[model samples]
Target: MTGRAHRDSEADRIWQMLVGLVWETRGEWRRKVSEATALPFSRVRILWRLVDEPKTLTQLAVSTSDAPATTVAVNDLEDRGLVERHPHPDNRRAKLVSLTPAGRRLIESARRTVRDDAPPAVQQLSKTDLAHLRRILERISSSER
Candidate 1:
């Protein structure tokens, strides 16, 4: 192969590996969160997003990629007292979802559980490697916007 072709192939391999790792890591974290919080994986994911900030049901649905699923999960969470749905200020038809104090605590516990459950290899990553990986991921994430 030419130099350019070789470089392209190597880049493709790296990109594929990175995507696989991201998906696998996300699954691992989700499972750990579910086990720790006693909540379904889907609900835990919604809570994970909301722990950062409040979002409208429309926004959550868009982010989660399934309006019906998001609506059902949010309704279930609301009934469990883990989330509150309030009227959006600007949009009368929209409702904003926020985590309750109990929800926050559960999310915190889930996060800690996931961290503690990390495998030996992940736990053994050096600080420098972790920081460099974070920087690379941040760059990729921002470029996607």
Candidate 2:
């Protein structure tokens, strides 16, 4: 192989490895949260996002990768009484969804599980490194949209 082409291939392989590692770490952390909450990973994700306040279904869809399935998930959560849907104040056609008290408690417990089980590499990052990582991730996400 030509030197430059070989170097490019190597770089691509290394990038893929890094991406895989990050995904594995996230999956592991999410599994722990799911177990602690007795909720599927997807539901736990929704609950985590709703911990603070109500959000529109569109917002939830945007926050989660499984946008198509969000409606069904919301319906299930509502059925279980872990979440509630209220009419949006400004948009009559839209619904604002939020966690119920039980949902909040369950999510809080899951959050604790995730925090306690954070990947060592992530937990050990220096504050500056963490900030840098966050900035980089934000830039990447923004560029995708």
Predicted structure with the largest lDDT when compared to the true one: 1
lDDT at 45 for candidate 1? 82
Candidate 1 deviant stretches above 4 angstroms? 1-11, 25-28, 116-132
Q: What is the alpha-carbon lDDT for the whole of candidate 2?
A: 0.85
* Cα lDDT listed for each candidate: 0.86, 0.85
lDDT of 1: 0.86
- Winning model by TM-score: 1
Q: Give every collision pair in model 1.
A: none
Q: Give the per-residue lDDT of model 1 (tens digit) for 29-88.
A: 677778888888889889988987899988898878689989999999999999998888
